[model samples]
Target: MTPLVSVYIPTRNRSALLRRAIDSVLAQTYPEIEVLICDEASTDDTAEVVADYARRHPGKFTYLRNETPQGACRARNRCIEQAIGTYVTGLDDDDLFHPQRIECLVDIYRRHSPSFACSRFKYFQDPAQIERLREHRYSETELARADKLTLPALLYANLAGNQVLTELSRMRELGGFDESMPSWQDYDMWIRLADRYGTAVCTRQLLSFVDDDRSRARIRNSSRRAEGSERFIAKHARLMNADQKRNHRNIQYVMNRQRPSLGEIARNISLGGYKSTLKVLLHKFFGVAIG
Candidate 1:
């Protein structure tokens, strides 16, 4: 029989953390679920870890190890393609889901029949930090009155909440996750889905045990990643509405705001030499916008 949900996990060289993520999914109260582990040519023992689980669980776990390093977006696409359930949920290798996550989400989907659903998530540096992660609970009244959140807002809110279980038809219609982007690919897809289908039905506090290590944040802060996100927003700008277009533009501005301008680059290179200083003065006087 087809499973009720397919939990998709895309991992790199994070075998240890991947085990934890898988364990959480296995522990879910919802039994009719399958786990699809897509490994992006991990250098670590990720293959061994996933293989062990697949060996033990057999039909419940499907493992795919890509030969090339196609990045997380492609890995996710592979997972979606392999999913055999009515619903699909993304489980990041480094994140953990609460035991009730699948149960709660599936219940909402069955009752409300929303195209997609998202829940509140709590972040943590450590298990003890879980307390610090909790803030205000999401209010249904507020969710009803709120302007449908754009993908950018959803990313900023960190509330796209990892355990997405959208209908398979809707997901395929949205073209799955964009494989072109390495980071914020989920953001792009979420924006498209929200604009087209609607705001994902909101559930309260279904995700937990998010690790906020420095390296993860640094990866998010990288210039290459930021540029990629900006380019994605720009590429999709024309497809968005007025508010969504504005949101995408704002994301671009925010991503590029701290970069050095042409004048600043020339000044740094010349070390305030007479010619460079004169050039800067000329540009300032002419009111040139040197980006």
Candidate 2:
């Protein structure tokens, strides 16, 4: 029997954009798949839209709507708990998947037997740009620097992005996303997954689309950042190296909107070096991301 893959989406009040995510998942070339959605107490007509898809696809979809919002972690966990497929992945309500995404991701298991597989996403502010990148979305698949995603390197940054394809059982074992993390929840979860299992590979192909919308950006720039970053460092501190600790300590300046003193700057240079120190300083003053 062909392996089944479950694609889960957790959404809230974006009925207008939700269809693109659903359509992209349903249109996958890999036939044995299920779409599980958990709506986080949306006031909009999100239910009606889900009903329309349920009617069209019948058993192909499973929909869950919470009366009260329990945040993204809980919403995703609810969907994951009910997924019937052996292998699973996630799609943000505003993101998309190329038709060959599933086929390409599952290929990792067939070819390299990796712990997990993810593809780089094409981020766009304008939806129209997606059409231009449609050519050969799955043309290439490489070992995607699995080495960099492990240990000290991963502590420096989140190279894995937000979504990946892996076994549902493994997700359960790792215990899904942490609800307490106000931000960087995906990064935290990936670290746990990497620690539990060995390194995972990624595809260089742009098989996914991420909408860089203002709403998403607003949530990212929220005030709870200090809380989240503090928790992140506390949880992973034991595992971090001297530089990783310094790097995150410097990150705290950005999170708390505090300018580092000359002494602190000197300390950042001790492990993080000048380039990494400058990246944080630029973000603190100009609100720009270096990479």
Candidate 3:
């Protein structure tokens, strides 16, 4: 039998964006998929909007609503708890999937049987571009290419991005998303998932990530980033070497919109070696993304 893929989206008051997200899932080329939407006590038109989708498409959706707004991570956990599909992946309410996203994940499972799998994504400002980029890429290299990811390398960065496709059992086994994390919740989970199960793979296929304020400046303004990074370091300390810790502590400065002090920079170079320092510097100074 064909496996059922569950795509869960946890949303808040953004009914309009929720509509677009759900539409993208419905538009997927994969036939056996269930859309699990968790409405986090949205006060606006969210109830009405979800009702509209449920009315239009009966069995395709399983909606969960919180009486009071739970945080994003909690909502995601709730959706995972109720998802009936064998395979699962997350879709941020503001992001989108390629029409073939589910099909691609299913194919990956059959081919590689990795514990989990993730892929690259495109950041776009205009919503109209989703259609054009969703179906087409510049070259063949952009499709179906997979690479093995190591835990040590992942400690330096979250190569898996925010979403990964894996079995529902695997997600449950890992305890779902960590609610204690102020941010980097996905990264924390991915590292643990990869470490315990085995190495994971990343593909070059693209998902659509909305490159608006939410993805950029607003994220930098988070008050909890420093706290979250501290928690991350604490949680994953056993998995990191001394140099990785130094680099991570240095990144805490970046997370808080401050430059690393000169002494700290020298310590990174001294302890982590110049090459690792260079990698950290590129992530901090240049626009090169680490995770």
C-alpha root-mean-square deviation, candidate 3: 3.4
TM-score winner between 1 and 3, please give it. 3
lDDT of 3: 0.78
Residue 86 Cα positional deviation in candidate 3, in Å, after optimal superposition: 1.1
Name every residue pair that clashes in candidate 1: none
lDDT, candidate 1, equals: 0.66
What are the per-residue Cα lDDT tens digits for candidate 1 across 125-177?
67545533433233434323212334434533335644577876677777888
lDDT of 3 by residue, 45-79 (tens): 98889888889998888889999887889999999
Local distance difference test values of all predictions, in order: 0.66, 0.78, 0.78
By how many angstroms RMSD does model 1 differ from the true structure?
Answer: 9.2
Better of 2 and 3 by TM-score: 2
Instruction: Identify the runs in model 3 with alpha carbons over 4 angstroms from their true place.
Output: 137-142, 214-220, 270-291
Candidate 3 collision pairs: none
Task: Residues 67-174, candidate 2: write the lDDT tens digits.
Answer: 999988899999899998889899989888888888888876556566677777777788878856654444443423223245556677666777888889989988
